[model samples]
Target: MKERWVVVIGGGAAGMAAAVSAAEQARYLGVDCHITVIEKTHQVGSKIRISGGGKCNVTHVGTSAELLEKGFLRAAEQRFLRSALYAFSNNELRALLQQQGVATTEREDGKVFPVAGEASVVAEAFRTLLQRLKINCELHAPVQAIKVHGQQFHLITLHGDIVADAVIVATGGVSYRHTGTTGDGLRLARALGHTVVEPSAALSSIMVQPHSLVALAGAALRGVAAVARAGKLRAERQGDILFTHRGFSGPAMLSLSRDVANMQRSQREAVHLAADLYPQQLHDELEALLLQHSKKQGGQLVRKFLQVSPIGMLLLKSETMPYGTIPNAMVPLLMRQAALDDEVTFATLSREHRHQLVVTLKQFQLGTVHNVSLDAGEVSAGGVALSEVNPKSMESRLVPNLYFCGEVLDYVGEIGGYNLQAAFSTGWMAGKSAVNKLLTAL
Candidate 1:
């Protein structure tokens, strides 16, 4: 067999996996090959080092395949991601790491991290594996330009020009530019006859207006939020809402960031988030409950109705009843209206006032958020269009011997280890496909 050189760009999760997989495939086929990983940064897998707050969420712990797929919301259809995921599922990924002496543990929500609870360990394991395989690992080698002539790829880097029989571009997306993902893949794909979607922020925080939310900056509400655009509810997600100093963050807001980013780009419109602070009951049900509580209590203020902690009840729990998690902003707004006479109490509220108060309780306006930070997101949402790349192989349909995987691709999964899983699966597929295609051609 001929000696083929496979070059992988970026050196993040996807590039590292691709390089390793290609080397494994070459060794298995008894084919002579040189696989090199080109990283622009000082350290490869820098993002992995910082992921999951330095814990490195390697993959989702959905032991079952169905639950694992659900983590990939608003992404390429399962039809597209099916083969890669099934071939290298969550358990398989964990087992592969285990073989390398890196054990992982699952969290309450199914996010899997190293048992050691440090991302650097996972990166080190990969580094040790590459060293064992004698795969070339180059750092501080930024890709400046790329071109293809005949069947070979010419990759111009800060160091110099390096030609390869095949190239896997896994340069990631625009998020975390400090980690070296500066939308290099998108630009490179565009330059190579691929359609590049406009990149934006995903898993990011939004900037909200209205003084009420601004006041309760540290408040966190455990409930559901309905995203409304043009006065119509577009989507709804249930999770913990984190109130940030800038605006809104946490799982729910970050999950809806894709739609919010689209709205910002397409219509330049601000969307309203109708937060159900007490999502356990419907609006009418909550209204009736509040009215019933008001009637039962004789001249008692809404606040003094139950003996509960001041801030925790208002912000955290909604378990036993609507006693807590009422959102600090709504406490004053509804109380000021529900109060009657000099003594402001729930019992003093008339039927009409109680009904209005209940309505507000069911749907507390967290206010309108206009923008989500692009650079602050966990992942960037746009990249090389899927149609231009073969999902099964992670190879570019338009550019021969050129491939893409990970955040460089158009599909961006939600938080909670889905993105990492996709990176591994796609890189696995790309590595095998690239090696097989080149060897077969020879």
Candidate 2:
């Protein structure tokens, strides 16, 4: 019998997992299988090397099928993921790292990271595992073309061409091209008759118009809520909002950006982002507090009380109020108004202050998104259309002996370890299914 062969393109998290899973499955079945991984970059797992800002958030703490199901975009995709996630939960992944000499620590938010605080450790674990399995790794061998021949795949690389019985396209999406995710997988899949969804940036920063209030850059307002509205539809997220020189970031802004991006794309209008700095407290509470404080410190300037929150200070400063002149009565009224209304209106800070306070605060809207820069993206949204692929095998319905895993497929998750989890899960299932199908054919 001819030796069974499987070729996995790309060597990021998905590719590594697929290659490893295929090799392991073949070993368990007592079948001779050659598993090869092709990476365009000099090193494998480049994206993993920089994931979580180098801390390498491997996976989230959610282990239940339902919670894990919430991570993917489609219901069927989530259902398909359950088996792989169960096979390798967060606990199991952590244990695997421990065995590889990399200890993991979980944050209060349930994000698991390596003790060394470097994504390279996670990459090392994958590399070590593949090495132990004797998987053939071809780094810097970027595939230029893929030709499907009857029951085999012919991959044309810069070095040369190689034929394999099965192929796994795990080349990821078009984010962080520097990390070797250049959307090659999507293109390759498309050439093979798979429908590729136009990719967009997910978990990315929003670019707001520059206002003098942008001076408040670097200030993070925690526990603040932001509502991104298109028309009747709105999405709200309450988290830390960080002001950046360009626009806004942090969890709140990142969460809002997704809806804003979608709205901007569909409506072709400026997306509205309203920030409620005090979401928990009611207008009456703020009004009462302000009234009490005003009476207690009748002589003290409002600016002094405003110093309690940097946002308050910015608001006062934007209104052109000198440090000592703002009245205590006005402070409470402003707070009350901000708390009561979903949108807080601010008077112009200056006749021509260059930063429109009202525009920056309440009407802080941004025009249609020109383009989401790939380099700044956390993950790429959209890939191979899920309808054309079988959820059970991650294999294309249009093609035989071909599979896709990771961001290369039309699967994306919100920030956290959701994307990584999906990649691991899909890769594992695809690997096992490919091996099973190959054996069945034999």
Candidate 3:
């Protein structure tokens, strides 16, 4: 019998998982299979080392496969991740980590991280597992190009040419370029006659045109519903938002960035973001509350109440009240109709203007964003098309014995552990499936 050689490119979360899982499948089947992982960087798990601020978010605590699938943004992504997610579930990954002496903690929002609270610790565990499995690892050996010749794959690299019976391209998307994820997997896949989804920025910060926004650059809002309008797409997310020097960022911004970016790239749509600081309160309810607060805090300066938060310092700077003068509290600035002058107050203002204040608070416009920089994205969305790969096995439908896993695929998940979980799941399936198919044929 021929000794099976499986080559896995990239050694991030997916590549390592694939190598180990492939070896495990071989062992379970009692097949003599050799696995090799070729990493471009000096070390494996480069991305893993930096994830969750060095404390590796292992995966979401969602035990159900359906819930895991729902975390993905696109319908195709959600559907494609189904089989792989079920094959090696979050629970199974958690159990494997626990058995390896790593404890985990689940946050209230379901993000799971190592109890050791160190991403290095998680990376160490993977390295140890690879060693135990005897998987050959080649670091600092980047694959320059990949060519499929009949039943074998020839990977020309900086080190040397590596020929293997099976190959898994686990190189992640072009994000975190320092981590060596420079779309190598996409290039390799495209060379093998696969359709590559045009890559775009995801989880990136938006650049707002309004210059006055810089004043509230550090102001942050929590549990706010951020609704983004781009082209025909209207995406919404609820979380924390940080007003950046350029525009908006943080969880809420990142969550909708991919969708917004995609729309921006595809269609020349005017991208606008609006934040509702209080999602619990309705427009009418907010109006009443604003009036009540205004009446109570009437004696104080206008900038000293919730109205200030609604306007932030960003909107205040736009007003024509001197160059730096703040609206008077007793003046009831929100209740002013004509030209917001020094005369208007709650006592003399019309009811219509008072209601408009509620509208202002409920729809705090972030203004039109000019661009979502691809380089700024945390994860690059869109890679190898989902149609080109088998979701069940993570195998390339066009090329026999060829597999792909991780962000190289045309999928991007919302922030949390969803992306990592998908990578691990698909890699595990691809590894197991590659070896299983080989054994069956042999």
Q: Pick the candidate with the highest lDDT.
A: 3
* Tens-digit lDDT string for candidate 1 (383-407): 8888888877988999888999888
* Top-TM-score candidate index: 1
Q: Score candidate 1 by lDDT.
A: 0.78
Ranking of predictions according to lDDT: 3, 1, 2
Model 2, span 97-142: residue lDDT tens: 7988999887887777888988998998999999999999999998
Off by over 4 Å in 2: 66-77, 281-304, 309-372
lDDT of 3 at 104: 91
lDDT of 3 by residue, 144-206 (tens): 888878788889998889999999999999988999999888888887899998999888887
TM-score of each: 0.91, 0.83, 0.88
How far residue 126's Cα lies from its native spot in candidate 1, in Å, is: 1.4
Off by over 4 Å in 1: 67-69, 226-228, 231-233, 306-324, 327-330, 333-343
Worst 10 residues of 3 by lDDT: 321-330
Candidate 1 minimal-lDDT segment of 10 residues: 308-317
